[model samples]
Target: MPDYKAPLRDMRFLIDHVFDFHGHYAGLGATDASPDMVGAILEEGAKFCENVLSPLNRSGDEEGCHFDNGVVTTPKGFKEAFAQYVEGGWHGVAADPAYGGQGLPSSLGLVLSEMIGSSNTSWGMYPGLTHGAMSAIHAHGSQAQKDTYLTKLTAGQWTGTMCLTEAHCGTDLGIIKTRAVPQANGSYALTGSKIFISAGEHDMSENIIHLVLAKLPDAPAGTKGISLFIVPKFLPESGERNGVSCGSIEHKMGIKASATCVLNFDGAEGYLIGEANKGLNCMFTMMNHARLGTGMQGLCNGEASFQGAVKYANDRLQMRSLTGPKAPDKAADPIIVHPDVRRMLLTMKAFNEGNRALAYFTAQLLDTAHLSADPDQRQEAEDLLAFLTPICKAFMTETGLEVTNHGMQVFGGHGFIREWGMEQLVRDCRIAPIYEGTNGIQALDLLGRKVLGSQGKLLRGFTKIVHKFCAANAEHPQLKVQVAKLNQLNQQWGELTAKVGMAAMKNPDEVGAAALDYLMYSGYIILGYLWLRMALVAQAQIDNGSGDPDYARGKLATCEFYFKRLLPRTATHRAAVEAGSECLMSLPAELFAL
Candidate 1:
């Protein structure tokens, strides 16, 4: 099998050395949280994933999800695996403490999420969607709703899903045909058919709470008219009948074990989540969280792929070295001795470590936004979080797919086979860029709404943080070059932001065409910052002689590889973004017609 070990030491290095998790949590009044406690929790989470979940990954993928007679059956071991997961209290890691959660920092939650996703992504989706649904309800639901659902969801007794897409509409919600009618009891009668609903139906939970998006009879046309509703599989009170039922589940390309259902809601009993005719706004609250989670899935899969490739490289002996056969006693030499193979391995290592640092920093910003005492600090945190969300989701996943692909390449023929598991990593990581709003959509949101729409204020604020870090660490020998390179990239991104913003004013299509490129550029610069931060931390550890020299040396070497090899991609993206909208728009609608 696959030997999957949690990188707990590296995780601690990022938390304590790079981002200062203890100071962050202490500032938030979470004085009870000690490094020992965090370490124990992560160890337990690692064991749960390795011992309980990882063993089921291949079986779940081969069996996939099954649907018959309007009931969905998960892959054989899934139900039992999920049951064990809940019993371990893994579900409440980041939930509110008042509702039976451990209320751990989101930073810790990020590590757990990465572990679970790496172990089995399809299995990760069930609770992942549940967390997103719970976030939506917690933000907009009434006291009664919270009392009824929050505890159950936090405890994993009940699961949740967001039912947004229909057969006709996936990204554009303006044309959705799902309908809702106000009832006499203040609830609504919802009627719609939703497709691509993950975790829609399963035997793992007692009930499934669906947060549905639909339109009212007299509601305004397009997106503004949309409304969100809480429609459960069974009634909340008596566990009686509800109008919602599963028609079937989709047979997908990957993440096969996670049930994707086609749900039919015929006059389903429903209650409004927030104000009527404002569902899109409420759904975004959940979508933002879901999008981030999807990004984490990408990072997690990349990490898994790297581990698998490294193991294979160390064990798989093939060609002899060009200079001499170091293992003349053996059949051949290890593939890792090849320079090209080493390049691929180094690429995976650098991207995975950089992405991990990025994810953790984003998680820290999220915590600070909610927990920081100063209003100015909170606002700054929120702005940075909002600005980085798209980067984290789009850039991380895009690079993640690249890293996994390289990992597969390192495995040679074995990587292509399903039995070896590397192929599954590629297939599973592919979806992160497509779902949770395609990377293209994420780019548009970043350029049109977050970056240029605000006249580049948010982007500027973010760069200022990088500038401060660079200034503070100017004397650090290892980080100086990387910091300078990042500064140059940031300057170029700022200029590109202005040029694109001005061109977008002439025609909105310009924004649509260049959004993906801009997102990639931004992602590279942000990762550069993460590399610099990690390098600084590793240098400190080495100077103080506080940890193993090899580990610290490995960290510095990865940072060097990132700066030398991967950071150059920013130039290509900058050029693409600067090419303007003509390349994409020049293709006429009739060009493809025969």
Candidate 2:
């Protein structure tokens, strides 16, 4: 396996230039994240990820987690590394200062997360789920709940997990069998089984705080009956063991170091977090956070794989250059000289950098949504976040899977072998699209719920921003052509929505039929707009003679590659969207496999 190096230069380019993160932080009144402070954090974060976390990635995967009796133990060094993370305050960089956190901007935490994820995805999962659990409690938990759980969670004395899935249900929370009964005391007794619970019973934290969903006896039917609860492994005040216990931990394809356990809450004492019969609504608070973090996994694994593949491409000798001898001293030229190899490498590059741009841009909105005082600003940010979140989760993972495959292919036969560590990237990324509501479900949420449900209002929020950018840069000397192309797509995006809206009106199934394709199409356009924005910045830097010239030009070249090569994928998805449901529904269910 090749050593992982944090792409600090590129990360800085996005933070300092493309997104203007410094200005964003100041606007949010996060003066604590001064430019110098942000720089120091990123540098120190890189060292921790590189020296501490990265080394454990492969070894952790190989060792996996151990399940004994009812206790879940993480692989070697995971516990110590997590302790170091907490001691260094890395665990609560974005949590509220009231809860013993550093009180940094949320976006800054995401910036740090990219490195943590890229270096050791399995290890990152421990804190990753905890952050999601914290968000839910912060948004919906009672003041008492916050004082008790958030303080420990923020201080890293305890970790958290979101338990929504049961063996009988995944996305359909409506039919969950978990039950919560009220007690004479203010608490309830939760008796149910939750499966696929990451960090559910890990030994890395002193206590595991579980945010679980169940129903009261008199509650309404379906999803409306659900209620959220905080069930801990150990009673907070008395320090006695609760009824919650690990039934078993799953043996999975990848991320084996992270404990994915089946948790049985056997009359566990639980406290309600939010309004009764509104558990799904409360869970969304955590689910949305988890979805975004899951989307980052695509970028994380793709980056790790890309680093390995690119290194191998440069060092591994293969066929000679077609036209000439680029490296005559060697018996054969490096594989990177081949056009086919370049194609795979460029594809990986275009998707990784463009996806990074999209992720960072979304992080800015996250900050505005959370930190801004203005109701109108917060609402706009929220609207945009709702629209972009599904796309970010679906599109990025789909392309991320593609990127990792290409990375493996770049290594030829060596890629298939486990020693090179390229194949593990594929296995690790495989679950991303399937989990977090699956890419299919994410697509339905995007095209069906968010786009059509809003009557196109949500779609317009994002397109309006793209329209404004294109209008401002319509006549840029270096990027006018690219800007014009993005402008045309911006308009077409609205037209496509209107077309789908019309079809969905006539046949509701049209939304379901066209959803995945529509989402992929939307994703390409979104990436195109982001790539143009990045190119605009890079070109301006070149003209002004600021920053590294090669780096600036490299951005310009990647932007051009995206426009010419990958943007064409939109055409296929567009065609699929326009095809409607007739062809799909026309086939009878019984005829399949016949």
Candidate 3:
């Protein structure tokens, strides 16, 4: 296995050049966070992830988690490793300062997340869930709620879980049957069974907070009546727990050390998160954050798999090259000498780098949207961020699975075996596209809510930014052609958006059927644009001699690969989107036999 190393140089290039993160941080009122400070923080975070958490990854997968009745235990060494993780103060890197948090810019925290996730995704889930829960509480919780749970969650003394899915209802919140009854003491009695709850029941923390979605007795029907509640395992006076318990833990395909539990809230004590019957709104706060993190998981796993494949390709001696002996003294040439091997490696590199840029760019936009002094600038940032979120989650995860599979293919038979850790990467990444609202759901949100509902305003705003980048860099010989390609794609996207919007008005199923492919097509164009921007940034840095020449050269090479090889997929996605709903919904119910 390759030694995990954080791509700090690449991260810095994105932050400093592509996003101008320092300026954004200052805009966010993070006056203390200079470039040097950010670099130092990233370095420490990288060291912690590489040295403390990464080594546990293989062992965690191999050992998995153990469940005994109602108690769930993580793999060996995870407890100590998690303690180290919390001790490093990483749990609150981007959390609010008012609640034992460092209040760092989310852009910096995003880079740290990639590193930690690349190092050990399974272990990463423990803190990952905590952050999501913390965000929900901070955004919607009352002052007392914040004072009680926020600080403890930030400190990593207690873990958190989001309980939205039941066995019957995953994406359709309207079908959820969990009931929350008002109690005499201002708390509610929650009784329901929730499944697929990550970090729901774990021994790592003294208490586990569950942000559950249920319904009130008098609530109207469907999603309009849903509500959010905070139920804790033990009743906490100060920072203690409430009466929440884990019914059992789930046995999953990968991420073995992360406890996925079946939680049973049997008359459990609970408090409302925000206004009654507005749980879906409050839950979206957490879901959106989790969606981004899940995307990072995909990016991180893809990078990890790529790193392993690269090492294996460079070190493993195989048949000699067709041209000549690249290593005449050795038994055979390295596998990297083969074009097919290079193809797989380059493909993985292209998607990993592209997704990295997209994730960081989105995070930067999030920070700007939150902290910009001008309301107009903030609204613009928010709009673009909303438009990109679904792409970040759906497109990135979809490609992440593809890249991981490519990495596994590079390993041949060894990839399938559990010993080399390639198979686990595939399994772990598979869930990202499925969970977090599923890629299908994300697609619907992108088209139905973001594009069609917003009347293409947000999409147009984003394309304008791309156009401006292209116009400013028109002199760059290498990137000029790629920028032109993006311009063409942007035009097509606009036309397609109009067509889909018009068609959907007549036939709603058309939107449902084409939504997924449209989201993917848009994502490809957006990521392709991002890759070009990153390459341009790297080229500028190289000319200025500010960073390593090899790093810049690598960036340029990956950008080339993305344009030449990966960008072509937009054509197929466009075709699929244009196919409309006929093929999908053409079949009648009686066509199938019982």
Candidate 4:
């Protein structure tokens, strides 16, 4: 059977050492998130994932979800599995206490998300969408809306989804045909068909709260006219079916167990969540939450693939090592003995660790953005999150797909087969880059909006942090090389952004041309800084003395591998970014087709 074990040790390393959640929570005055409490939470969360969720992953995929007569039934074990999850009090780990939650730090919620995602991504989605909905309602919903919707969502008695896409529009929400008419009783009659709604219609919850985006009559044109609505599957007051119904679910390439529904709202009763004509703005609250979660999915998949690859490499014997057979008793050495195999393993490892640092750091910033008392700190954190979210969404998932591919490659032919389970990881990871706004869109957001829109202030927010870290650790005896390399990249990031900005002014297409490469280049540098931070923590642990030698040594070695092997990829991206748009746009649109 396919298997997964939570990387509790590494998570603890980040929580206890690198980001120092103990200190972070203490600073936030989050007394409930004490180290022991957090540790217990991680331990319990790990058990739920490893024991409860992991066992269902392969079974869920093989069986998938069944759609019949406008009804969706999850794989046999899913309902039960989700029940255990809800019973564990995990549904509201980070939600507000007033609404049946544990009232822990939001970062802890992300920690559980990573675990659940790695264990069973499809299963994870059932409750995952609820988080984004809860955030949207909390941030924008009125007290009545909060009491009616948030209470049930936080308690896991109800689930939620975001209904945005339609037949004609996916990313272009302005062209969506969904319409809402204001009624005498204050509710709106919502009529539209929304496609690709994950967890939109499911049997796991008593009710499903859909946050729908539609246009009001006489509303302005395009995305600006869009208005947000809360359309529940069961009316909160009447307890009767609302207009929302499951038209059908898509036959997908992967994540099949998660219902991707075609929801038809035929005069469905919905209450406006935010001001009319400002739905897009309100929807961003949910989109951003989901975007970050999607990015974590990338990391989770890479981590899952890496775990499989490591186990397979250590057990699967192939050819002799260049130096000689390390396993002399066997016919040939384990694949781990080969340098090429080691390269792949290290690549996955470096990215897994580096991305975890980035995610955790971003999570810390999220806590500050949401909870910090200091306005400046909150704004700085929010500004940095705006810059990091797209990078997290795009770069992590792209690399995640690469890692899954490599994991399967490690198994050679066996990886392609269903029995070993490596291929499923690849298939499941493919959607992350496509959904949550395509990576291309993410790049555009980074270069066109976040980076350029702010006149480079947003980019400066993160780069300045890297600059400060480099300055503080410049003279370190053990990390001088990494610190130097980081400083060089740190300096170059600003210069490259400036160059792209100048080129974009001369030709706006230059931004589009350079966006993908720029995002990747930024990702590498960001990971480089994260790796440096991790190396410092690992080095401190080693110097502090007395612990598992392999864990500490492994951390240092992987940091070195990232600097030597992976960090240099930024050069290629930098060259691509500097190449401008002339070569890219010179060809006519019709000429290439023939």
Candidate 5:
């Protein structure tokens, strides 16, 4: 396994030059987030990820987590690594200062998350889950509730988990069998078995805070009746075991080091977080966080795999270039000399860089949504976020899977072996698209609800962004080609939506049939806009004779590659979406079983 090094250069480029995060922070009233301070934080964070976490990727997978007698212990070095993480205050970078957090921008925290995720995603899950739980508490928990849970969670003395999935229900929260009966003391007694709970029951934290969903005794049926609860593994005041226990840990493929526990809550004393039956609303707060984080996991896996592939391709001598010998000094030539290898490498490069831009851009939107004092600004940012979240989650992960497969293919047979670490990336990333509301579901959310539900209003918010960008760069000599493509795609997006909307009116199945393809189409254009933005920035740097020449040139090259090679795939998705529901729905339930 190649040692993971944080792509600080690219991260810095996006923060400092591409996005002007410094200006963004000042606008948001985060005066303390100076360039020097954030730089130091990234520097220190990179060290923590590179030295502390990267080494654990393979070891953690091999050791996995242990389960015995209702206790779950993480892999070796995980406990100590977590303690060091807490001591360093990395857990509270983006948390509120009112709750003992550092009061920095959430965007900065996302930067750290990318490093942690790329280094060791399994190790990242513990703190990742805690942050999600903390976000829920900070948003909706009562004053006393915040005082009790937020501070501890912000400080990383306690960990948290979102308990939603069950044996019978993964996406359908309406079918949840968990029950919460009201006790006279304003609390509830919860009894349910939740499966696929990551970091659910672990020994690293003093106490585990579970933000659980269940049906109240007198509530209505289905999702409308669901409610959120704060269930702890141990009573906070008494330090005694609560009714919650780990029935067993799932023996799974990949992410083996992260505990995926089947938690059994037998009449566990749980406190209601928000109004009864509004749990789904509050749960979205946590789910949104995990969804975006899952998207980053996709970026991480693709990045790590790309790094390995590039290194191997440059060193593994195979055949000579078709034209001539590129590396005449070597035995034959490094496999990188091959055209197909370059295609794969460039594809990974294009997505890895394009996705990074999207992630950080979305991060900036997150800051605007949370920190802006202006109401309209906040709402606009939030709306854009609501529109982009599903796209980012599904599109990035799907591309990540593709990138990793390409990465593995570069290695020939060695990719299948554990020692190479390429296969681990594929196995680990396989879960991202499955969990986090599966990519298929994400597609529906984008097409059915966000786009069509609003009559293209939500989508226009994003396309208008591309609209302005294309308008601004319309005259650039080198970029006009891409700018024109973006302009056409931007217009095509709305027209396509209108067409799908018309079809869906008559046959609702058209929405489902067109969704996944629609989402992918949207993703390519979204990424196209981002790549163009990078190209413009990089071209300006090259023209001015400023910045690192190699970096700038590489950015320009990849941007061109994406436009030429990758962006055309959007057309296929467009055709698929416009094909309508007939071909798909015409197939009866009782198909030809010949």
Candidate 6:
């Protein structure tokens, strides 16, 4: 396995130069997160991840989680590492101060998450799910519920999980068989089994809080009847074990260290959260957070694989360079000298860096949405978030998967070996595109609900921002051609949406058929825009003789590579979208096999 170094130099570049995060923090009223504090946090967070978490990654995977009976014990050093994580106060860096948190901006928390995930994704799951639960309770839980759960969670005294998937249902929550019956005490008794519950049962935290979905007896049918519940492994007041138990943990292909449990809640006491029969609405608060975090998993695995691949590429000598031997004294040139190897490396670099930019930009929007005191500003931020969230979740993961695959290929046969740890990244990343509402679901949500559902208002919310950006930078000296290309693609994006919208109005299947392709197309454009943004800043630094010119040049070069190579993917997706639904729908379901 490659040594996981937190990419602090690139992180600093994005935070300090590209995004101007200090100005952003000031505007968001996060005065506590000043330049010095942010700097200190980044350095400290990097050290903790590299020195503490990274080392345990391979070992954790090797030992996996041990489940005997109902108890799930994490791999060696996991419990200790988690304890160190909590002691360092990393759990609540972005939580509300009123709830025993440091109350920094959400973006900072996400930055830390990138490191945690890259270093030890399995361990990160313990807190990743907890943070999502915190968001849900903080947003929709009752005051009493908040007081009971949020404080302990923020203090890392307890951990949490979002339990929605059942054997019968995954994305379709309308048919969930879980039942929540009313009790005299105003609480409900929840009874059902949830599958694929990450951190559902663990020894790392004292208690496990599950925000579950179930149906009440008096509730209506389908989704309208669904309700959210707070089902803890142990009753908070009594400290007695609740009826919830881990029936078993999954023996999975990857993330073996993270306990993926099959939880059985047998008449467990649960408190209703938000309005009755409105559970899905409330759970979305947590799901969205998890979706973004899942997207980061792509970047996380990609980064780890890239680090390993790059190191191996630099060290592994193959045939001589096409023109001449770059290393005459060393038998043959390194694989890094090969064009195909460079292609893979550069592809990883472009996607990783561009995706980071997108993640940070979206994180900034999260800060705006959460911290802005002005209602209108908050609403605008919320709209942008709604539009971007699916793209962030779906697109980043897709590109991230591609990046990891390329990284593996760069290692040739060694990449496929278990000892190198590259294959583990591939397995770990495979789950990302499948979960957080499969990339297909995310695409439908993006094209069907978020875009056309809003009559393009939501889509406009983002494209307009890109418009202003392109208009402002239309005549750059070094990057003018790329800017023009981005501008044209931006215009084409709107036109493509209009085309799909018109077709979907006549046939709703058009939306489903075009959604995945449309989303991929949208992703390429968004990344293109971000690449341009970073390139513009990099070129400015180069022009004015400020910052590291070498770093700036690398940014510009990567941006060029993105435009010339990856951005062209938009054409293929666009073509598929224009191909329409007939080709997909013409064949009967039974004909698929035949």
Evaluate all candidate structures by whole-model CA lDDT and list the values in order.
0.88, 0.92, 0.88, 0.92, 0.93, 0.93
Name the weakest run of 10 consecutive residues (lDDT summed) in model 1.
473-482
User: Candidate 3 lDDT, tens digit per residue, 18-92?
Assistant: 888888787678786788889888889989988988889988888888888888889988989879888888888
Q: Which residue runs of candidate 1 sit more than 4 Å off their true CA positions?
A: none
Stretches of candidate 6 exceeding 4 Å from the true structure? none
Backbone clash count for every predicted candidate, in the order shown: 0, 0, 8, 0, 0, 0
Model 3: lDDT of residue 178: 95
What is candidate 5's CA lDDT for residue 283? 93
TM-score of 3: 0.97
Model 5 residue runs over 4 Å out of place are none
Compose the digit string of candidate 4's lDDT tens values, residues 55-144: 999999999999998899999899988888888899999999999898898899999999999999999988889999999999999999
Q: What digit string (tens of lDDT, one per residue) describes model 2 on residues 1-594? A: 668899999999999998999999888888899999899999999999999999999999899999999988999999999999999999989999999888898888998899998999989998999999999999999898899899999988899999999998999998999899999999999999999999998889899999999999899999989999999999999999999999999999998898999999999999998999998899999999999998999999889988998899999998789899889999999999999998999899999999998899999999999999899999999999999999989998999999999999998888999998898889888889988799999999998889889999999999999999989989888889988988998898899899999988899999999999999899899999988878888888888999998999988998999999999888898889898899999989999979
In model 6, how large is the Cα lDDT of residue 20?
A: 92
Note each model's CA RMSD in angstroms: 1.3, 0.8, 1.6, 0.9, 0.8, 0.8
Query: Model 6, poorest ten-residue lDDT window?
Result: 470-479
lDDT of 6 at 542: 84
Selected candidate, larger lDDT, 2 vs 5: 5
Choose 1 or 6, whichever is better by lDDT. 6
lDDT of 5 by residue, 183-233 (tens): 998889999999999999887989999999999888898999999999998
Per-residue lDDT of model 1, residues 553-574, tens digit only: 9988988888888889888888
Q: Tens digits of per-residue lDDT for model 6 on 137-207? A: 99999898899999999999999999999998999999999999999999999998999999999899999
